[model samples]
Target: MAQAYDPYTNVIHTMTKAMEIGHIDQSMFEILKNPQRETKVYLPIEMDDGSVRVFEGYRVQHSNIRGPFKGGIRYHQTCDLNEVKALATWMTLKCAVADIPYGGAKGGIQVDPGTLSERELRRLTRRYTFAIAPIIGADTDIPAPDVNTNPQTMAWVLDTYSQLKGHPCPGVVTGKPVELGGSRGRNSATGRGVVISAKLLLALEGKTLEGTTVAIQGMGNVGANAARIFYHRKAKVIAISDVSGGLYCEEGLDIDAISLYLNQGGKLLKDYGAPGVTHITNEEVLTCKCDVLVPAALENQITEANAGKLQCGCIVEAANGPTTEGADDVLEKRGITLIPDIFANSGGVIVSYFEWVQNIQELTWERDQVNEMLEKLMSKSFQELLNVTEECHCNFRMAAYIVALRKLVFAEKMKGIFP
Candidate 1:
């Protein structure tokens, strides 16, 4: 039987492999293997019906050796300390690979946000924020939105943290509403980055996005935005899915219309209907015919069971740890180029860095400026990855991990042990 998938273990395995390939120093390997701290909080929130419930939440600070701990907070039913640890580690690597001045951290609650009413969610958010406020700050750890969380959630966190401090603390969190000091182009930054990664990869083969076929799993913020951006760039988004299900079109999908429907309210692609669009199971979407398959949803979506069945020419991970280490080997054997999530989805955190800079500097940049800067940073990082790939004679994923591990280990060496 195949081993049960543990994201934390998977990350450690990858790091070990990268270290072996890069011949990195083993002294800091132990330090990098584990998180610096892990905080678990039990939040008691009163529902609109006057009943109280306790939800488990966690914040894993993987490292702050590079800079402040920066990552996202997600509300997921299966969230736990291990997942947060793995995500935190990924954030550390992501910032390093992006060459951004930030460390790695992640927060999550063990409740399905959809099951709660708006008021209940707000209470939960405030309570969770209060539980974690002591550790998170602009110069310390900054939190942003992740799965099942958005700008509104960050707003609540900002308000609660501010209330506790008795002052406006806009820098305490990223991905807030623009009026509250959030940066422009932050929402679509990750998706745009995914497309940019794809474009970069395609260019390596002398191809373009003008007619590339793409399939994206997860119609949430990252996936939806990526779909729209891919459509706008003239790529045929033939398949897209969410938790409910998936929708497919042989020619192409009307991502704008579908995005409109989803944004209207609580919408699911399974219930969405349009001409020339066929509803398919999420599994089918994964194995569907496409030039690029973007797993933008949660982790472990693409595993060994289906890695060999994937029909896409490339996989650009838009979600954190979407591909397991086992699946990575399979794809490597299959000669399927898989871009690791740390680098591909670094757009969100990169822009989060921009937002934090804007907040600290008390300045605002136009959307165009923010986007141009994002592209420039991603392009530069892509070149770095390419150079590392060539130097190490390894795949993109390993090259990225090597680049990140080098930066992190060097920083830790410079800092030395704190006594």
Candidate 2:
């Protein structure tokens, strides 16, 4: 029987195995296994009700050998130090696999944003920013949007950081509104990266995106954007889900209408009535008949039990650690081609790098330029991943880890054990 998985331990185990398989040096592997810094902060915010509330917040900078620590700030009820550690470590590996000039870091506040009013959320964001302001900067650690956080959240971060400096410091955060020095395509970068990964994978098999059927779980920033792009690419996005519920149709749901509906607050698939569309549970959406399954939601979703039930042809993980180690083994035994989260959903950070570059250079790039650069990076990284997989005779997930570990371990070697 497979052991019950702890997400952080799972990440460390998989990474360690990849290093061994790739014949990376043990000393470097030892250094890569742990985070460089983990800071936990207690944020006290005065709510609009004139009540004081304390929230737990965390920032974990995993590595900085490649470049500045870069990742998103997640605001969810389940956010904790361990989860933040896993996310930060994934960010490091993701950036390295993409060959981008970034290390990995993640920040989170342990509160459900849904339960907070916009005013309360803003206060919380500012306070959290102030709490971590000293350690985060343009060239040190940059933050963007993640689950339950968006451009507005990043805007608040940029503003709070700048307010403390008494000068505009837009570089402190990416995924801000474009007017605030964010890149043009940073919002949809992760989804676009997913689409690009799909395209590259299909093309390698002499297939194209036009007729592919895709089901995506979690229609937030990443899944929704990926759905839109896949629809635009002529792929039939057969199913999609958010926190509320899921919707499915064999012929394809009208993505444009659904996108518009989702933009309105308090909307959900359970309430989204459309012709020939059927309401489905999140689990049903994952196992629905499709050519591609993109689990863009939370971790530990496709675990051992559910992994066997997945009916998709390919699994493109758009969420961090969406599949458990046991689930990975099952999927591998079944010969399913899965593009792991570290690589499949790396689009967000790649463009975050662009946004950071634009910020540091004090320049803005056109949408086309931003998108072209994103495409180049995604496709190039996909090719390199394939090359490594072929050489190592390993699965995509293992190959991705190996590729990332090589860069990280090599950097550690060059830096040579800091005294």
Candidate 3:
């Protein structure tokens, strides 16, 4: 049997390795292991079918030394406190890696959104917002969208929070509709960042994103947007998947048609069919022969059990905690480069910082402006991570942790213990 995946443990394993490799941080070791705060709430919403349901929800703030608590609210059936804690920790590290003025936080409710009707979903989101309202704010803790939550969900959050505050508090949420002060390029920021990470890593070997055979393992906001962007950039997306299953094509699939089909109600790739396209299991998608393999799905997709089976030149994580610690060793031994999640998927939070800045100042930026700023920041951070990787003689994941831990520990040390 496969080992159970615990995101918190996974993060700690990487941090411990980084601490040993970096070899200068023992004072704050205990401080780095635990979250600063973990808030849980019971949300009761009236269902459309005349029933009331209560969902368990959580918001974990991992750190706030750098700035306010910043992260997304993910709604998945498997969402729990531990998962949120791990994601919150990554948010802290991700912001430090991106050099953003924000700490780490993540909120989520344990419920399958697909089973909720539109009205029920809206009520549940609003109630959850009300439940967590006391702990979240524009300058204290800003909530954004994540898996199963999107601009619409953020809109509800913003509206609910604003209603409570008795004013338009756009800064309280990051991924709301653009008309309501959302960032212009926030929708594709994470996906674009994944592609950017792949491009950056490939460039080290004198290669470009064009003509790269890519296989992505999720088709949600991040994976679908990534596939679209990669396709537009002339990358051959040989395989892609959603929660249902995966699809593959050796000569490169017609991304445009597949996207349109999925967007038009063919929600799962298991039902998506076309000429020359072959249906494959999600496992096949992960281990497919490709230049780049993107595990954009949920956590623990790549574990020691299948780590040696990955056939890609490199792996770019679009999701949080996609690769396990044991898998890290396996991939390293196999000579496959894996871009750490903290650095690879930091784009969402980076642009989210931009959105928060704009909302606070009542200003907006053009798409090109946001996109350019995002690329510059992610690339600069990537360069720094690469430098640390070389200097420490460590893998990308550990190097990223060392870089982030240095910043976090230094801040904590300077701030000193609070009374």
Per-candidate clashes, comma-separated: 0, 0, 0
Error of 2 at 270 (Å): 0.8
Q: What are the lDDT scores of the predictions, listed in order? A: 0.94, 0.92, 0.92
lDDT of 2 at 26: 84
lDDT of 1 by residue, 332-380 (tens): 9999998889999999999999999999999999999999999999999
Give candidate 3 regions above 4 Å deviation. none
RMSD from true fold, candidate 2: 1.2
Reference-based TM-score of each model = 0.99, 0.98, 0.99
Q: Candidates 1 and 2: which is better by lDDT?
A: 1
Model 3, 134-228: lDDT tens digits are 99999899999999999999999999999999999999989889999999999999999999999999999999989999999999999999999
- Tens-place lDDT per residue, model 2, 243-328, is 88899999998899999998897888789998899999999999998999999999999988988888999999999999999899
Model 1, residue 313: distance off in Å is 0.6
Candidate 2 colliding pairs? none
